[model samples]
Target: MHPLFADRPAAGRALAGQLAVYAGRDDVVVLALPRGGVPVAFEVARRLGAGLDVFPVRKLGAPGHAELAMGALAGGGTLVRNDQVIYSLGIGEETIAEVVAAERRELARREDAYRLGRDALDVTGRVVLLIDDGMATGATMYAAVDAVRQRGPAQVVVAVPVASEQACRQMRFVADGVLCLRTPSTFFSVGQYYADFSQTTDDEVRELLRRAVTAG
Candidate 1:
């Protein structure tokens, strides 16, 4: 009915409320899927008094239909493909490789720009709160969850302000805890639920990460 969030910061604060159980835990870390997720994660990390960092991930949207995710690429070569989309669309392996190649370049560029020489935060034996603005097909978030899992985090928690009903269900299998503040069955798009779904910039992400790191 009403707008679920005023903006990314509002959504992040709402998400942080859902994640209050993690507040003040030294072993907890919030990893954002920049650049949109950074704002949200910044609020969460601020509220929870947790370390914050970026976990770069790029979505591989299907050719000719860029909104439809065929797969995603996360750091450390972790990839999760939507086989149903790929098979149904008859997307070839070469196409997949090409998409991955292109996205990897963007991912690397984002990591470099966002981190600005800071090393990726280590998640070993800690609780990793993997946050995003929202989830549609959950492709990119799924890949991020898998990539973080490999680094031996004690737990992986997927948290978002809103998501499709299917996505909320899907993430349960990937993370130790999945927190979706709203799972609308009639969801049209993540942006539809937000009053101001503005584009998040690299500068904004870097600034938030700088504040988080400096506060830590």
Candidate 2:
């Protein structure tokens, strides 16, 4: 079995097949972790014919290592930190606070930019399929799941194309369902599995969100 994917869309299409059970349900909504997850979730939302919306999340990247996720912050002011990464890397509360404060600003900015004055979809009593491109440390996805839970989703399913084995294990407990198309034992980063893992621009996210809404 090849774990590689051509890109986020390709991976998303593959991931949607596993979620056929949620197809065409009026009470189902697909919430993507923008801006990367937007593209992936768009395909899923399109396939399932579900309403699509953004659940903004920002990773609290480690100091001096912006690529490394020390934790994450999501909507509803939810934060999930990796204690092992924090304690081992000597990340202090002061530093962590600084990171979260900055990310919260960006998260708010994205929520506004992506929505473009459109109110967020009401997820209460709906089956929320929370989509992200992939999972590595899973801090971001965990934060998302936690935040969504507070909004009273009937079921929160964490769906991704590829993820580390450990990430999948941690998600299953917090999320009502976890569907990962591939769980590679040798996973390092989400980008490694994709052939064309280029950045997803804000404009692209906006366009896709419009298309998804129009398509529905």
What are the lDDT scores of the predictions, listed in order? 0.93, 0.92
Pairs of colliding residues, candidate 1? none
Q: What would the per-residue lDDT of candidate 1 be over residues 1-216, giving only the tens digit for each residue?
A: 677899999999999998989999999999999888999999999999999999999999999989899999999999999999999999999989999999999998998899899898899999999999999999999999999999999999999999999999989997999999999879877898899998998888888999999999
lDDT of 2 by residue, 1-216 (tens): 344899999988998999999998999999999888999999999999999999999998898878788889998888888888888889999999988898899999999899999999999999999999999989999999999999998999999999999999989999999998889889888998888889999999999999988897
CA displacement after TM-score superposition, residue 65 of candidate 1 (Å): 0.7
lDDT for 32 in candidate 2 is: 95
Alpha-carbon runs more than 4 Å astray in model 2: 1-3
lDDT of 2: 0.92
